[model samples]
Target chain A: MIKSKLPKAFLLCVFTLSIFIVPSLFAAGTQEDSSGNPYAGKELSILVSAGWMDSRYDETIARFEETYNVSVDLQTVPADQYGDILQTRLLTGECADVFWIQSNPFAIESVIVDYEDFCIDFSGSAWESVVPEARLLSCKVGDSLYGLQLWHNSPEYVMVYNKSMFTEMGLEIPTTYAELKDVSAALYAQGITPWFIPGADGWQHQLAFFQIGGIYEANHPGLYEGLNNNTATFKDNQTMLKVLSQMKELSDLGYLGEDWIGSNSTNMANMFGDRKIAMAMANSSYIQQIKDETGTTDEFGLFLLPLADNSFFPTNPAGPTMFGFKGTENEDLVRLFFDFVCETESLQEILDNSPAYTNIHVNDDAVQQHWLAEEKAFVDSITPDQMVTPVLQTGTKYTNDYWMDFGADMMSYFIGRIDANDVLGRMDANRAKSAKIAQDPAW
Target chain B: MNKRTVYPVWFVILPLVFYVVFFLMPSIMGIFYSFTDWNVRNRGDLSFVGFQNYIDIFTSEENYASGIYNTLKFTIVSNIVKLIPALFLAMLLQRGLRGKNVYRTILYLPAILPFLIIGLIFKSVLNYQDGILNVGLELVHLGFLKQKWLSDPEVVWKTIYMVDAWRGIGYVMTIFLAGLNAIPDSFYEASEIDGANFFHKFIHITLPMLSGTIMINLVFGITYGLKVFDIIYVLTNGGPGRTTEVLTTYVYKLYSSGQYGMAVALNTILFVITMAAGVLIVRGMSRKEVEL
Candidate 1:
């Protein structure tokens, strides 16, 4: 009788202990996590394009997760498909806490056109000052800030060429389109691709035409204003026509590459190291990348792309900008993330982790920058007048959104399927379509 | 027909309700949306724009008309390219070929592989500079024959067709193999006794008996052809330029650009095409059945 009674008592004690212990254990965990933080158990989701926020931000994000005891869901979409996917997610009202865009000054007004409805208004946030003054145009639609631009203020998409190769070949950096053609011819004679324009990259090839917006503005004064005011169009623009013809001429000569349209820039550094190519359209920082990646002792330098006699610097203040999705359940958490990313420690971490960029463009005084001397030299060489005009795509309204479309049109023109005029005409029509959608009075 | 072969009305009622609510209603709504100025911007309310969207598709300088042309061309050509080879392969394997099962498995392997994987592989294989095909050609004495397979406007469509055929032929052939197996060996044996050669037997016996299977393939091929997107998208992305852009790709672009009205219009055009093709195909099959 004692033994049977003991067994029943043991069972009852075990069940009662479990009931008391389990609840307390959960309560302890909850208290521990939520003790010092209001957003301890919340989640922050970021939707970004593939290359925008890579593994460089992983550690920073992890730190944020640990400090706040929160989880971050990072959804990186492939660059080619990001636009469609973002649009789909936004349209379906299922967008993440944060989303990113390849933003320009006109982007907030043009791309995320319904910015007031879509983005969280961070007008008076302390983090707004961390962003550089030049970058605010891309980040702000007006006095209201919607995006955080974390990008380098270095020369972007300039002609990064092998200085050693050009010197060895007895060639000067061509300042005119005709001289550029001659340089290409001389390189092609030696069984080398003179200009490595990776057409397969989808958006790389159009840089030759659009990066020279200053030249276009110089030739056709107030062209940017004309374009924005709807008093002008890309169609039948003689300067644009001349530039297209020169690009076609290069294509016809096979100086761009044996098959630029079929190839990507995956092995570009290796190609540079091997001295198989003389030059390419790349950022000033790509010089350092070539040295680090391929150990190429061959010195590389930057030049203005000599397409259509472009002597101007591509003064682009645009880059990948992140915005808070207004529809998020964790609005405070989203705001916290924007603030967290702007902190000096986080800024330093991002710059240290980013191998592609030599310097961070933020206005923080504490963070040390590793700016290349090559960049300084290139900037010094360009005249003050030359740097006045922005790149063609960003200067005009609603142009950057049609980047991929224009690239496709350029590809067609290069392959002999369509004339140059048709490409220009399509851009005009596409811009008009954007204007119609925006309900812009300028149209 | 006996009542035993027929199920109760209530048996189908649940499935019918599910179809109407989930599939039929959404499709009808999509059609309705196509006639309006509904887009990403105007999510709150919608306004009717009639056939203006449809008119814009043909008239717009975006050259959506060419996309329609490419879609139709791809449909006809891709079917021809797949069906004939699949049929022949099925016939060859149906005979007493040694190691037939091994061959069948190997051939059907590609069919099981997803299109995304196939596209990535082919893009590498067809790259003009460092691709295996061009390199192999150069390794041999056939370097002169090498062309910019994907970049050349002339060859881009051909490359797309080739890749599509590679992925699809096995599936087509598998269906043909099953149909061939269903055919009685007695038909061929009887024909052989009557001095019918292989060609004669194929023309008289095989063609006549395979009519039902042929119709099945045609119906499937036509439908698949009309909705073709993945192959074109993965391979060239409707480029070297928009030379390979199809209606679906265009629809996707327009939709992504937030021109939902235009996108829906393109889709509606595709819907009309598919419906018309379906009607013609069904009528043709019915007439053939009556004749038989």
Candidate 2:
């Protein structure tokens, strides 16, 4: 009996010790190689615009922090002030370890003209292969990768209208510019706001003109190439002039909301829910947002922005992208962070966390995409040929750099302070200024 | 006097160093940068461009000249709107009113609030379609008087002046109140015994006595008006088609868009204008004091 008891006691002691010691052994075993975990105690800082990162990156950033035993300092600035703040910080050499830009093919060359001096070249980074081919233009400045763009491919800046409201009014969806005008007039006659232009936002009103790049390209043929190579100018562009004139006419006729110029988008979703406005320019995802915010079962649908009789899609591949700052002390950590965010788990976590987004456009098949049914149907309805290159702002070389200036010019034109031709001329002058600053050979 | 007994030169050394470093160095550097082709593209490697930035500011089709004109207009008009009423209010509330402290607190309240908060509150209050001001007018059967407070170019400047005055009058009155309090009651009493009316007493005793205070307010108000950015930026953002574009707003736009050299040139221009105005006002006030 004593011998049996001694054996049982020894077994119990071993079992208790295993509970504490085995996990430690496993933790020690899983410790990465010295080169792999070299940045255990370092910190990484990222500066971004408000909505760019939000909480979608929280889970992935937390996972990365756990894995590397490091912390990430995320600094978010208001959208309107981000450009000025980023430029100032960059000039002062006090920029964060990582910074973001709303990047396109020409953004690195035009927006951050001193890319070589400021951006860390991630030419041979492991995560390069994860990005899609088309997105490479935004991330690379001539073969050298300077940014990491992980954004969705949702239908952007289309006409989102209340389907129930249109049906209730017995109005068919407008397919042409003339039809749109007629619908707007009918709605205006009914004492309803036909179209809502939140001009106070300073950025929203320009989409009606730029999103119809297909119309401009079809009319001018080599317009994007000409604009880039300095062979053509926004000045005397007949299609653009027509679009601007039509927009102003709508404003003058009061088809747009009364005091639209003085109004902002704070109450836009509520207005849509209450049926105060018929249609507005927004992303396809904003339909979901409106439904969610108002808890209204109002059926919303997307249509091509019918300005200038445009039937083509606004194929904007541009989005806010991150870049590693060249002047950071923790280069290895920055690279690690980049790689970590591209992992399958991290990608999935980001997509799952982003309630505003439905999918993440990436080349990896391991990541499951959550495409909304409404967006999918809209995408399917557009013809293959009509899905052209990006909108005018993102397609052209330096045009987007002056988006705010063009918006201001458009406002000035609307108020009769400046002529329509003068507005176009100002855009030309702005493009020339950007070309000069970039030292582009085309200019 | 023994050399040791003389005031030590070190007494002024720290402040002199601070002034040179903080104020003088930055001003000189700003002037120097205005002469170069300093921009975001070049960053630290700026090239000498002579007066190209200044020429561009004046000659460019962007209507920066209008901005300069607007700045001067705002300075003169805004000061006139505030100073006269502020003086009258100061005298009215100087004595003989119940709840004068309450009135004083109410008036001084807006001065202590940040420009950002004031802008946010007033922007909402002044909205055209659903704003309290227009809505109240509509409810009172005065809908015809409801104007587009921020959108209409014809009325936007007037609206801005109103808002500026609303935020500024109380503070200006407070300064005048301090000056009013400093005056001995004997002068006013003596003037009253001499059978002088309120206007006559104001012109003679109050005006002459408060000359120093007026000069101080004038200098402060002039500088504030010329350097005005927050109010206009928060209100119209130099909008309704650059109708309210002031020098500082233009300078801000240029700087934000990476035209650093041109921005500094515009600032240099404003600095010169402000200095000239200050000197002229000081000299004029000094001459008046001597005459008195």
Candidate 3:
């Protein structure tokens, strides 16, 4: 009887120990991955326009996935369709874990419309200091940070031209509208399309007018302020009229391109590689892209867009910015992702992978920059006063929201359907409409 | 036909409730919103402005009136382009033609594709500089025939029509094919016996018999044309200087830009136009039927 009791007791003790100790032992191993994170095995999704985040973020996200044991769904939308799609998703309360907006100082309030309800409050996050001071305005509303703008500070949307081609043709860089027309005529005579404007893109063609905001400001010192305050209008401004006339003249002469009105930037690099085109309104970083994509031996350089005789650097402090969705289920993961991207290693990795960009403009000094020599020379060439004013679309209130409409109007002007004054008058009307919508008392 | 099989008036109550809640209520609310200060900034709270939205549509510098005009033009032109050719194609495929099934499938394939896919394909084909259409024209020594298919304002509308017809003719033909199949052989044979040629048979027998099909096609075509967005959007996006700017494109732009009142007013105009056209056609067809 004693031996039988002993065997039963021994079996009972073994079963009892297995129940408690086995799970604890298993957890000890699993804890390495979970790290007490409830969000483990969950999915985090990001919605962004195509050019905003490409394969540059892929490796970083992969590393993040490995670290968190979580999956990341990166959705890249076409630039033209992204605004509508994002707004639709946002209004439907179906936005992804993280989403991006082409943000400027006023974009968060005007574009997002209700940033408080939508964007996560990352005011005190570890990544706050990494954002440069100039970008802070775009990332925050009343000092409560809502976005992370991880973008390059390259001269945005300036004329990128083939230096080799210009040298071969004995053409000097144009510094005025008259010189631009002459150069364009020269290039057109050589059977090379000059000043290639992808007007069909519905976005690119307007840069020649908007990127030289400093020129506008210089001509009329109080124009940006007046526009913001609803005290001024884009209508019949002589400088603008001159610029519009220049663009129309280019379009009329076919110097922009044979089919520039229906062209896109898809084959632009190849166009440069083949020396079929001379220059285009593109980011300074595009010079590297042209070399990388087409394996072109020809050197490229940047020049101020000479439309309206403007010499200002396109000092746009706006960029494609990422925001954590306030309604996201994986909030912790979103926070972690933001933190991960801002780290020194990740920043360096992003800069290294982005062949289109030269540097990541952040406050972190640890990350090495890869600024191109041409870009550096271009930067050095600019006077301190040249960078004083932001680009027109971002500097003025509610302007960027009507970007497509303005582009269309510009198209209308280009094709002679509407005159220059009509284009400017329409912009005034649109701004008034948005001002009314925003309930701005100034309107 | 059978009274006993018919559901009672009270039986519709459940579905009526759903229809009112899901469809009717929202539509009425939308119409109400059209007159108000509704916009993206103030979604919940709005004030009635009473025809101001409509006034803006008619008078705005953006030329909303042109959008309506374009919509109307498209409705008339697109139908004329599609229906006549589709009727002939249907008649051709309905009868003893070699490889009828293969031909039918080949024609029907485009109709099944989504507008997005069709738009992308057409956009690539219609690209001005290096598109296959121009490249092919050059290769075959017909280079001068290659026009700026999408860019030139004079050609953009024609290009849109061409693309619209390509995708739509197949579907329209299919409907006509069904109508043709429904027509008994005895009528054609009887007409043949009476020394009627193909045109005579078609006019006297086929057309009168297929009046219902024609009416159905007309209504479908008109509505599709009025609400056309995707094709124009993908190809030109109301470009070549708003030459292709239709009502729906204007509405989309306004709506997306937080001008909901304007968007809805534009929509209301579309709604009225569609309904008015629908009523006129239906009434006309009914009178025709009575006359016949």
Candidate 4:
């Protein structure tokens, strides 16, 4: 009886241990999702920005899952932390099957230096036709297409203001830098913040100064080309200093907001909703976001930033691009997913779901464009002359690489740690460092 | 015929292998990489840039030097705040305090809470505009004392130190309590016979006996303070014009910006500082033990 009992006890112990150990051993292999689909045998993961991919993609993803007999694992990280996370995963050789990049012509070579190593060469894929020629440059490295960037040609990073609020506060749509200062004072007098720049947002605040690349380049011709060649410097530019000081003047005067340094973009929509601030710099899509998320009844409109007496529009072609991981075991499935997203039905569904977006920057004939009425009105208000200049970050060489440092420099300037010229000098130094590291011919 | 004996020093072979593989090798490699230009652009093309990265760290006119100063400031201040208060609390709890276990548990709870949760909660509580801390101060008719907690460069470090002490004091106090409990009742009895007063016994017996524990806490606290990241990140992210920027934050920034070589160099410096401090602490404690 004792021998029999011992055998049974040992068996029970072995059985219990297996239950705990086996699941963990297989944990990494079993990636699941809440996505509804009949085919759930294989798994696919996509990395995308927070606001870029609309809800219409859900139906498309579900359809792809059903047709391809795979489960799509959508891992959407917030924009602020996206770069760090994506870089870590890519470098560690554990990248998602289908990853993303806010790629431009230079980005593929500069940012993803090992595109051929990690990216699946999608050179002759049928989906290549749907991407616009200008945007096609963003997705290709050498002669091979390695990414697909299908984004809108809408006005981006433009100054969006509450028109009703401006009228109520007796403020004008500032046409020049001087007029902007006067208008800010007028709004501040009425207990309204003139502009809401979320400086604490690691990425957004610097857009005010950097987005006007046209004026900077136009004012000093060959500046962009010179910076790329390492011959030009951002240091001690009187125009940039003027812009920084203007920003500082506004910040110091409490026209940007009472605690602009501590504020984040998370409360921006709410600020617009609550009428706490008169205006902010945002993409055209964001006006829709402000209305939908905050349910604000305030009428909002867009205007060119009154910087440098310049009325240039930012024609940024760069948007989030999808690339396949060459290291992925399921390369076929990844290719299929990209192809599937390019289909007419899927593209239409994506557009329908994207209420914020007016249109997708694609050449697909079947996909119906859905530009918002407000965006159309805003575009109509602008002249053709104002709609041509490319925004600064994407337009210049090695500029985006120094964004965080520039933001920090701006903060330093605001708090009086560094002068306006010093801030510009730091930007030049950062650009030089990046240029050196990149070994760009311009440097 | 000679009698031969063999001992199993092989008993430590597995653990030693683990220590070398996980700790020693990576540490050595980190230092090695720090000297090379090993960034994202040069992933497959590493070149030796001996002392260049370090030179930039030391000589660059940027805010890197201020980070070193801030890091040192935090380490010293945090240790003093945690160690002194912890020692006193440990003594109090050892003195037949009511609900001693409950107090100990309460004190230790914050130590176990994750830094992410603690940071988020404290950030909200410390907000100047609508935070509970300011509201409470206002209710008490002390609105004058209410100030921008995280936003103000002058008060941000103090706020971090206070939050850190609040979370860490309990853990340190627990260690001291263990040291206190280990002491024999006979020591106190003999002291009483000699008519030693409270301070007399405390100075001669308690403190001397707690030296080992104190040394251990100091080492742990110093290393932790040196590598502090989450609290500063979640509260202010080394902001308000880099007032609270530390070595770790700089390293993090470099890593995030894909400056892997510079990032590794900063961490390598931290590692050296930590190891040096650790050796000094252990040697000092051992010498004191021999003297005692």
Candidate 5:
């Protein structure tokens, strides 16, 4: 009886030990197999414009490469030539694994017309939820997601002025076009450039006209709808013509810098610091840059671009956004790269590295944002009515595609080569061309 | 006949095949596509649109006509500016001078440097405010003479011609030097014995001797100026408002905006112009050669 009891106890102990040891062995094996990164040894390439990524993505991209044991090939092209390069690459089926576009709500369709053919559908991606609903329109066509827009929420293309200088000059921020002209005249009389429009940049000077879209829409209700539906045209719009005329007046008066058409924004901050120019159109974040680069102690403030008696905020939600290429052989690696960048750690790295940006406009609460106090105050000061609609370029379909052309036309008008109405008419013709290409029924 | 002197027809086959595959095929395909409603929207499915693209090119309010006009203007002016100076420089350098090789090297340096680097340097130098050129003028009390070299439409084309000449004169001079070198010294010696001056010799002997080289340079320069992009693109980007816009820039804009058919149509028009110009130039030069 004693021997039988001993055997029973031994058997029970052995069975219990087996239950723990076997599961532990299987769990260790599974962990080892699953933890092996699938993206290891793969390479990912990204094509982007210079300022779009800059050094802001270096840390995040480095960490991504380290984590996955891979390499990232970043091809940066000049901003002016980026559109042409991107178009050629996409058409030739030689696009990189990742590509970027200056995306707006209508850009994915209007700019990259064949998004389905070129971009990978990230519809069900885990990172899809990380993008905010407003930005999703830029990232998606219908229900299919194709881009990830990690942009700043700073007030872009607003009037950034030296507050201290304005105070010293006994000048108040101009709220109407007439006051703007008065202030400009006063500044010009004093031999100081009132506004430093960098027309040589080709894209910067157009903000005066397009950033006042709220004023245009307020004057003509359903203007955006009409423009989109082809019931309206940019031609013969009295407000726009007035705005163009005002711009031409500013150019003619030489208040828009000495040879503004030849001036670029390279030394704009220095000009602000030296007090050579009182104000210029720039992002709210540029105030910090001016302080940092110029080491100026002067207080800077943001205001609405006063043109054509306009008092409206530039309600623009547009920025450079990235997409995975559909033709990439390493789709899994591309997906992993996207997922890696959207992670909270990577988001923090990106935000920290971005000196030009104040905050990443994402839905992630864990991601720490560095919103500047002045930028915050500027946003808070905007009235509800001021934020009427998106800027003209982003609001209308196919409008932003011809931004450079429109700027050129505006310059032509300024130089007395083309009339204001011809400038507006040219815009109408451009929109029609784009609409025809887009096959928009409205046109 | 020797086998080397009487080559087989297969000798031309390989090069012809490559030419067709690489050049002729793409050009033909491009011409075909120009007639279609090909765009970014119609990727993988292009539809024929007859002469609509051409019609748009001509009738559109985009001032493509101005672009064509600018192209012709640039071709003519750029060649004149470049060829004349290059000829003079070549003649000067061909004669005995101190450190002629060094001068040649110095002159050729701009041609060797990439257009992008030259553009970047000159853009800074030509800037309206704080640029070296304007500042230098001010230092010398010649500030009144300083004009907006790049911004004023009146001065902008002249500025472009200056920059183009700077980069291109050396290459043209080098070619001219080669032509000059090929001329026997005996012609100049005989002309010297005839009491011929520099102008007389240049007209009678140098001009006739270098006709082939001149024709070559003209063909090269005209094609380059017709397809002028990098210099203008880098300097003014067809601006102070489209006063500087040429056909290539317009084509680039069209292509960038995803209007493939229109872009191709514009290029086809350019191709036609280039070919016509080439044929006329070569035919006239050949006729001149026959008369000589």
Candidate 6:
């Protein structure tokens, strides 16, 4: 009886010890973590825009979990609805542990002026090295770095054509605005819509005119700066009016497809697959999506849009960047997660998983790039003359703020409710509205 | 029993408390927020800016005015479009029609299906060039009738009404059926004995009896129409140049774009419209009750 009682007493003591010591053990264990995080069992939630990041990052996530013993709940909202959902959550004060914003220099200040309220300051993070100076301008506001944009350098928002289609028709890629018109006419004569602008997309159609901002700025000189300062206006800008007219001409001439205004990007792949449309404005990676989805036989090629005799690239450096919510319960965990993502192995895994991406712009040398031969070949084919200035929408103030309005005005122009100059005037008025809201001196 | 009679006012207190907390408080708070400069950038640094947002809403050239107009139009048109056809279908199914249960089930299926699924399915079916609707029309040599159902501003409203009716009519019919069942069979028999024809029976007995159901449908339809966003968003996105813009869609745009103050103001306006409509409908129903 005494022996059994002794074992029971020992067992009781052990239970009591466990009750007292288990939490202390955990606390002590996390105290040793070097990344300034002591919440090992905690979770970090990151909300992202869909289609911006591919599934290849799953490996990196798993590895990060293994290394840190913390879970990362990466929720990617659908691209179209993301903005609204983010805003609603933010307003309701139920935002996730971390969140992403598509920011530029002006965007962080203009769109998310309350970034300091929500942002976890990363002014001196080691990961800042990977971003180029031009790109850094978008990630920073004042002396603080609030966003990390590791976007690929690609030929963006330019006219992508079926190279095989051009070759089969014994035609060369058009080099001038008049040549584009001639090519379009020839394609139509052969029973194909030469340019398939999915106006119903409400986002894609505007790129044709907006991405050719180099020509407009070159002609007007200080046009964007003037607009930013409120001294210049989008209305009566000669080059912009010409570009808008040219777009209208394309729509009117049946080159932009019969029902271009009503068409969505959902069917563009099928249209290309079936050889109904010869070209569209898209990113270099989109060719892969088209080929994979439709199994199209036509090989694709990129060309600069011939608006205003322009030869500039749309260097769209904008992408989702993570920021720590100030109100998060596990702020330490969030910081650790960011540090883990910047590590070489995790970054490499992310790039490796992205089959659709050619490269991930990062400062770490260990992360390998997966640039395809075709992409390289396309880059090689571009002459120095064609590599003009970057488009000015992103760098300037209060311009990207009116993206949706400009799109609507362009649609109005297409539908004949407004003229080309009126479309320009609307942009100016919308800018003035934004400038007033911003309390900018330019207005 | 007389000795045991008590006021029992405590029974009302719980529900009253719940209503004040959940419904009344939030509504009052929403109205208060609308009057202030309560935006995302301010981070709850609210200051009263009375009627500025309201003024901006009305004077704004962007889709706000059209959104209000579309909301009113949809409420009127959708109710008429759904309620009348549903009443007739309810009448037909009440008769000795063969396979009525199967028909009812088939009709009601769309009503119970998720709105997201309906929006997705209809978007495909209504595609301009190769959607099944257009293709079917072409196959039957009715190609001329085919239009860009979701894209053409002229016909987009019609398509929205059609899709909404397809989803809502069966539910309305079911309600009408319940009303039809509640009406005494003896009233119809007495009408028949009085030498009343089918139209005469329908006018004298059916019409007066089904007024409750019609009122219910109007209330439901109006509320639904006022709050419509998902179907239009999935189908047209207030596009072909905001031609299909409505009040809720406009509110959604503002909210998503981080204009919380403006969004709240829009919602307050919608709430006022819905509340006023609801009160009027209830009052009308009550007056009809007294008359009956």
Model 6, which residues run further than 4 Å from truth?
A1-42, A66-72, A266-274, A285-299, A372-388, A417-426, A429-433, B1-6, B43-48, B136-143
Tell me the spans in candidate 1 whose CA falls farther than 4 Å from its real position: A1-43, A69-71, B1-6
Candidate 2 lDDT, tens digit per residue, B1-292?
Answer: 6556678899999999999999999999999999998877776689999999899888887879999999999999999999999999999999889999999999989888888888778888899988999999999999999988888888999988899999899999999999999999999899899999999999999998999898888888999999999999888888876788899988888887888999999999999999999889989988988987
Model 1, clash count?
A: 0
Candidate RMSDs in Å, in order, are 4.3, 9.7, 6.9, 4.2, 11.9, 5.8
lDDT digits (tens) for residues B1-292 of candidate 4 = 9998977999899999999999999989999999998887777789999988888888775667788888889999999999999999989888888999899899889999999899989988987666899999999999999977877777888999999999999999999999999999899999999999999999999999989999889989998988999898777777876778899988887776678998898888888878888888889988998998
State residue A140's C-alpha deviation in candidate 6, in Å.
1.7
Q: What's the lDDT for candidate 2?
A: 0.88
Instruction: List the lowest-lDDT window of 10 residues for candidate 4 chain A.
Output: A31-40
lDDT of 1 by residue, A1-443 (tens): 99889989999999999999989889767865668678877889999998788877988999999999899999997676688788878767799999999998889877887888889999999998998898999998768989999999889999999999888989998999999999999999998999999888787898888898998899999999999989998988999999999998998898988899888888888899998899999889889888988887898899998888888999999999999999999999999888998899999999888777889998889999989999999988888888999999999998889888999999888888788899999998889888877878999
As for candidate 3, its clashing pairs are none
* Predicted candidate 5 versus true structure: per-residue lDDT over A185-281, tens digit per residue: 9888888899999888788899889999998998999999999898998889999999999888888989998899988888898999988999899
Instruction: For each candidate in the order shown, give its overall lDDT on alpha carbons.
Output: 0.89, 0.88, 0.89, 0.83, 0.89, 0.80
Q: When only chain A is evaluated, what TM-score does every model earn?
A: 0.91, 0.87, 0.91, 0.88, 0.89, 0.83
Better of 1 and 4 by lDDT: 1
Error of 3 at B272 (Å): 1.5
Q: Which prediction has more favorable TM-score, 1 or 6? A: 1
Lowest summed lDDT across 10 adjacent residues in model 6 chain A is found at: A384-393
Error in Å for residue B64 of model 5: 0.7
Report model 5's TM-score to 2 decimal places: 0.92
Q: Candidate 4's C-alpha lDDT?
A: 0.83
Error (Å) of candidate 3 at residue B89 is: 0.8
Q: How close is candidate 3 to the true structure, as a TM-score?
A: 0.93
Model 2 Cα lDDT, one tens digit per residue, A1-443: 99989989999999999999998787655655543776666789999987789999999999989888889999998565577678778777789999999899889877777888889999999899989988888999888998999998899889999888889888989998899999998888888898899988777898899989989999999998899899998889999999999999999999889988888888998899888898999877778888878888889998998888888899988888999888889888888889999999999999898876788889889999878789999999998889875699999888888877788888899989988888889888888888877777888
**Model 2: lDDT of residue A297:** 85
**Model 1, A185: alpha-carbon shift in Å?**
0.9
Docking quality class, candidate 2: acceptable
